[model samples]
Target: MQTRRTFAAGLASAACAAPFITAAVAQSATTIRVSTAAPPSDFLNRALERMKADLEAANVGIQFSVHPASTLFRQGTEVPALQRGNLEMCSMTTFEVAQQIPELGYFNRGYLFNDHAHLRRAFDGPIGEDYRKAVSSRMGIEILATHYLGTRQVSLRQKRNVKGPADLAGTKLRMPAGPEWLLLGRTLGVAPIPLGMPEVYLALKTGTIDGQENPLSIFSAAKLFEVSEQVVLTSHVVQPVFLAMAKPVWDKLNPDQKKAVETAAKAAATWGDTARLDDEKTIVETIKGRGLTVETPDLKLFREAADRAYTGADATKAWDLQGLKRVQSA
Candidate 1:
């Protein structure tokens, strides 16, 4: 009683790189159900859609259903759903994974990654293998590839001079609910408010939240500029999300289908990464065209505060410092 609409895989055409078992001969074509909080406008969702189309078009003897905008599960619930066998796939953030496996919080730390390349090297190297094993062993999930969304910057409801953390002591800022995000919010010297992605716009519009932070591309796609006034270019953390699938679901897939899923996931991640990197080059001007003020605060002061937060705070007690060093070396 899935009731989810999907197409049967067509015969593999000459256009396809490999042939899949035809639907007529295959009795176990499972549908991969993906849940994400990103809206259709966000590149993450678009990349998921592309992955769906790719698999279907390749006649991979499987189906894909991408439920965007938290329509399937709320922002923070997809991981649990995947663990419970209620979901098949998702883009799980490091912050969410660290919530369950605290040691992985190293990846979610502020100023930990210098750029997307550094993040990728850290993840693609041996350090990342340990993390993959931990998540798979404990969470019943298998990660496919890294999705680089872009660097996070502060988007405020009111235009002001945010020279340093002291400039925003009482500001009510929305951070994704987790010690990692909340700790970073406190490091930025704001009253960290936990809010889901879907609720951010209304909260900002209603003046319930003073500001939020995300990549420039997401800020533009989410239309936060409509409700906000300025963006502080903190460039705090280069965000990376894992294209993860339930291990149970993966175990059910034949080797061919598993390979297909991995291929599509990596291709989609590349699609998103390329688009976001290209967008970052000009999105500053794009938002400015929409009449939003973009400011570059002294990132040095912000980095110093973040250093103190990582070393002096209790949250880092569970972080993998060895892995942190490996990532830094990467």
Candidate 2:
């Protein structure tokens, strides 16, 4: 058993397996794809471009290919794709994924953050960390970071100003296909038609839907103002974006690589947030120049309705009344 022939046989076996181990290690350095539902010109899309540059400079052999407008996957497919290892990363609205994980919808709550600073603090604390862990455990994804995507504004086909809840009655509101949006529409007593983004403009033009809820960036980019010129500053909900990576992809990275990606993601989020705010200002002026009637409602009724909606069935596990109160307080 201790003969030279036996030792040589064992050596041959070990040598045969060496290439397989090396090949497995080499596969870890392969490309990773990231998807976004937004168009190429979107603020978050631009941020992804920056992230690509940073990753390049950092010499991350792991290539990152950014797919815009859901080329790789749709908004609803983000979590599932990442979980199933079909996609490596994604940037999406939390509410979009909240359909599967209800707790994520809290990030979309109306008037949840008074300003950008408050939002950053709340998200950088225990609440955001908890959310990330919950998703990692339940949804099988790693949330690298979260940021304000955009501020939602109301757009209508008619000239009726949305000054209060009464004005919204009987109006067909196009909301993203999500439970929270449906709840918001139900609370306001409007007929909510859950539809995709591309279908929104045509619906408004064809009278299929009376109006749609979106931020200034979306309305302007989609040229919804062409069909629905009336813009209301309901600021109904704050659009929050979460940048998530597949857990398997993340696990493959060395600690240093993970840190670099994390830093780059946070930087990208900051870039996106700043870009969105600047675009908001520009779009506001542009909408005014277009002679669109933008109204600032009393906001009291909308706030109350949103609070009640959150306290209703939608509140279960998504967020706590007290936690939201603490966030508001902060």
> TM-score, each model?
0.91, 0.84
lDDT of 1 by residue, 212-306 (tens): 99998888888889999999998888999889999999999998898899999999999999998998999999889989998988888898898
Model 2: runs farther than 4 Å from truth? 1-28, 100-105, 314-319
Steric clash pairs (candidate 1) = none
Q: What lDDT is reached at residue 256 by model 2?
A: 76
**After superposition, candidate 1 runs with Cα above 4 Å error:** 1-27
lDDT of 1: 0.88
Tens-place lDDT per residue, model 2, 106-213, is: 666777777667777877888777778878888778888786777777788888866777788988998877767787776565789988776777899999999888
TM-score of 1: 0.91
Candidate 1, residue 40: how far the Cα is off, in Å: 0.8
Superposed Cα deviation of residue 317, candidate 1 (Å): 0.9
